[model samples]
Target: MRGEGMIKVTLVRGLAGKPEPHIQAVKSLGLKRVGQSRLLPDTPVVWGNIKKAFYLLKVEQV
Candidate 1:
């Protein structure tokens, strides 16, 4: 899980006043604060969550 198929998802923006779903998506990614990041598998379900909160995240391949 630490190889080519991993992606880094960072909380680049504050979640203040964001919609419930978007907040939940970020939380599900294991991020709880600005600047926090998570190394996640690059799969459809994770991608779906990232897409839901794209504006609040910074995604990059690792």
Candidate 2:
């Protein structure tokens, strides 16, 4: 079963030439490459990072 406060974040685009902060945000979510995904807590901090790199990610509620 999935936790109510969890989310799924997937790296859908390459990071090449992207802004440093955006890259950092993706890295902070523990994503290293395209097609990679991480199960993360749904919190303000995680949402902040997701907001920063939304264009590069695919997010879903878990």
Candidate 3:
């Protein structure tokens, strides 16, 4: 995320009527639907956000 490039963050689960915060977290991660994915920089805040929404998302470095 720093020395190299972006990492892949993907939404691997459904968000059926999830809480506002969880929905916001997914939105903040730039994910809208299942299988939705994005490439983001790797950082504590970014990773923290990802972790916060781990119930709805999965992250991997690529």
Candidate 4:
């Protein structure tokens, strides 16, 4: 069966002077520009990824 839940998240900030790890986290989430949204599985792994860039994103549900 397919998963019934998903997390909607977006990259809403820039990388100017930010740590390399944080910038890389955004890139790892397949975000390369501001205001880019990416839906991911609502799992701990996904949560961890989001946590890494918590201050740099805006998440919402659809």
List per-candidate RMSD values in Å.
Answer: 2.9, 2.9, 2.0, 3.1
- Model 3's lDDT to the true fold? 0.80
Error of 2 at 57 (Å): 0.3
TM-score rank order: 2, 1, 4, 3
The clash count for each model shown is: 0, 0, 0, 0
Distance (Å) between predicted and true CA of 48, model 4?
Answer: 0.6
lDDT of 2 by residue, 2-32 (tens): 4358999999999999999999999999999
- Model 4 pairs in collision: none
lDDT of 1 at 39: 90
- What lDDT score belongs to each candidate, Candidate 1 first? 0.93, 0.93, 0.80, 0.80
Candidate 1 stretches greater than 4 Å from native: 1-4
Error of 3 at 57 (Å): 1.1
lDDT of 2 at 8: 94
- Candidate 4 or 1, higher lDDT: 1
Clashes of 2: 0
Error of 1 at 35 (Å): 0.3
In angstroms, how far off is 40's CA in candidate 2?
0.2
Clashing pairs in 2: none
Kindly provide the TM-score of model 3 when superposed on the true structure, using C-alpha atoms.
0.81
